[model samples]
Target: MASSNTTLAEASNITTMAGRSNSTEAASPYSFHFGMLLNPDYLLVEAQVIFSALSIIWLGAHASLRRPPSAAHAKPKNGKKKVKDVQFAEGFTASDAIMLPVTAAIVLVGLYYALEWFKDPDIVNRVLRIYLSTVSIASLGAAAGHGLDIITSLVFPGLWVDRKGTLYRVDSDHQHQVKVGEGDVETEVVEIKTPFPSFLSTLPLSHGKIQAAWEIRNLLTEEWTVRLAAHGLGLAEFSIKLNTLLGFLIAISTTIAYNTTKWFFLPNLLGSAACYSSFSLMSPTSFSIGSAILVGLFFYDIIMVFYTPYMITVAKKIDAPIKLVFNTGRGVSMLGLGDIVVPGMLMAMALRFDLHQFYHKQMKLEPIDLVSELATATPGETVMVSETQYRRVKPTYADPEGQWGNRFWTTKLGSLSPVSIATSVRAATAFPKPYFYASMLGYFAGMLVTLTMLLVFNHGQPALLYLVPGVTGSLWLTALARGELKDMYGYTEDGSMDVEDVIVEVDSTGKTIEAVKSTAEEKGETKDNKTGKEAVARTEKGEGDYDVFLFSVTAPRRRAPKRD
Candidate 1:
């Protein structure tokens, strides 16, 4: 009887242990080893460090940009010489664009070889940790490099070399014009030239100014084509690509470091120290995970949504008109949201210990009451709480139904809400159905492929890698490109082709836009002057407005004479 009781007790103990193991497996996003090794305390410390370092970098960059250049790359004092040199530097040199992609490819390839040692599981898991201690110091070096590059750009602003070999500069007043030529020879400066308005007025009845407009229009078209040929649309696109490459590089480096050595804590210690010491004063706790990981993601978003359009606006500030703010907002809403959603979903999956949890949560939260109740603002226009104070007064207004303006209403209404209504209308009447369907399919397919690959490998969480270029990267590429067409470039909120809807182009000589009917007639592109060129028509107020233009030329073009 005693022997039988012992056997039963053993069986019960084994079952209990098995159940706990299964529960833990279901809860952890990554492998058990990762959970055990990664100290949350260290992550918190690292986060604080990263934020501090980033703050210092930004502060230093701003200060250096504001001050006069004392560095070797500083502008020359004399106006003519400064312009000449600046133009030379800004113009697209042969090595500038080519080197970016070539260098990235080469680095990635080299890293792959260097990390062959990681193929050995023993070196990677047990011994490599020691080597990371030394190489982690290089992160500070990378931060320094990034800082220098930014300051250099700010100090020597608008030194862009075009394919036509021209240098343009932005003055204090924000006007952009060609500042430098091939050499220092100064041509006779014409203070009063043929005004653009006067040129427009002089067009003949037949093609009007189409011939004249073609001169500038052709160049503008070609420049954009060439930019695309370079495999990216703009600086924002370039940044995205480059940052991806940087992330891979960091991953490879860390992988190699971990594989080659056993004691990696030294580098972590130094990296954490540098990250914290530089950033702790002002930076947030999110930046120190790695030099490239946090900043790269944030920078990519900022570049795509804000910086890229702003640059285009600056390049064509004078002659062509484009709405920077609207374009920015659109980029943020569509592209930014799409990009972030993948990673965010992954994070949600990690939290729930199952990738399906993201979808489940979406479905679960659909009918729930999402509410936020705010107390009335005090008399002094200051909102004070237990641990925080604010100056802005909260609005008391709610929706027409007397409910708070929380996003829950939108979820509850589903397709009946304004956003869904607009999307449905676009699908029904305006947006190309096949194209929309194709893009949606591609996005979903990409996400599935990414998730499958991660599950197959049994590595880290998959969501973090979804935005990454690999198989997952291609998914976002199509979505972003399509979204740009469907969201950018169309009409204003009022459904008019205002100056804000224009696409501006700039090169070595000047700025230009697609020739309007009046100007295209002068440029000789359109032979009939009596009829205006047909602008792409847009749908009603609710339908989406996006203008994705494909340029045909290899270089930028500008108007010969400034229009009055």
Candidate 2:
């Protein structure tokens, strides 16, 4: 490892010493990427990769050892055992399959154009164009994020975050009486909203924020809206004056900032983080989905990295915030967050699947189908959903190479129920957790291997080319050996709920009509609501942090400021 680092250093030093106008053009295996890091003179990216892998392992361990529902709501489905086997969609629908390529095209175009225009010297008023491009690309990226969520929904209905699936209702506030003046007691009511999570909405991660340049964006949007309203209302005089003044003010500020500072970081950081966060936390509802992402991205990375020089060219020239950057005094090393996030997410879900298995065994709860009639339940009460599960033994693919074919596990699914985000948080604690850790460990190991090879070969390699096999292969082998093959295959990170329809029964004689029973009536809606609310408040307070399952699982260590 040390020798590898030394090799990279010696090569970099030799290049620097040979200083000529064509230094960068004197190409080798690696090309200079833009953004904050200029050369691969440091091991920061490798360190970050290792750090994230370790974090994943630790999270898995913690879930196994520490997390379990304190009380498993003993409610059985139709007085039967709960089936932990997860149901999965056979394949993606038509629209979703098509969008996958559309997504790839959009990203490629954005990357090419972002880098091209940013570096073009002949372009007039470069900063203004940069801002425009940033907005356009960002909007496209957001659309892409939304599209991924839609794809998620196509497989597992209730998993998307941008939609509201959780219901948080307000009860009476908690009032604290305090003495204000000598004679008056001031009562302050603490407002509270109780979120009741259905099994479905609990798995995905989300955050809310706006950064520096975000302010400028809002300003531009509002100005355009105000101007449009004025003109539409026949206030042409006002619209002209206002639009001109606002435009002038924006132009001046943008020009100064772009000229004075490194303006690229804003969009760079925004785009990279957004993609990383969304993809990393978007858990797969089936083995197929995870496989699709890994297989797709693996080839995507390879083709972009080795087959064509475009990716490196853009990365080197843009010098944008698209990567998580760490600069050493000599040079910088950068890692694309995707390299950590995509595989890391799949690893995280495997861990959760293990955790759930642990609880089922420890508590001796029987497996029942997740049949859903989501009426309010008492806090700490596990509501059992008994849904239909259709499993079939199938070959991986039709191939003449093998005698018959490699067999795999798969399933079919119905619609999903609306679940609360809070349920996911609980499910995290209740289930037992594992190689999601091993895979994470493999990720760290693979990353080190990748870096070492980079040093030896002195050329760039597509990281996923190493990573896909390292993580996925390790998980596959481990699961097979441990007899957890069914567990892994059945592991769907779906927040799916189901309420069975049963309004009629028939004997051998004639059909008998039966009235549908109301679960709310049995539980007493009022009491159920109060109990559910109280339970929610307690869980919210006691649970403390659900983010243990979030990006933090592979969160990078905060680097200290670069040396002078």
Candidate that scores best on lDDT: 2
lDDT for model 1, on a 0 to 1 scale?
0.27
| TM-score for candidate 1, residues paired by index | 0.20
Candidate 1, residue 492: how far the Cα is off, in Å: 23
Candidate 2 to truth, TM: 0.43
Q: What is the lDDT of residue 510 in candidate 1?
A: 38
Error of 1 at 333 (Å): 31
lDDT for predicted candidate 2 compared with the true structure: 0.41
Cα lDDT tens digits for candidate 1, 1-564: 001111100010000000111334445564433452244432343233223323332232222111111111124442322221111112122242344334433433343343453554334323323453344435434444344434333333222222333333222212223333333222323221111221232435344444444333232212132222222332121112222234345545654554455452433333432332232112111111121232244333333223323221211211100000111110110011123222222221121111111121222101112234446655545433432111111111111111111111112232332223222212212222232233234434443443343224332222223333322233234335656332222211121221111123333453332312234323545323323233212222334543354433333334353332
* TM-score leader: 2
The deviation in Å at residue 518 for candidate 1 is 18
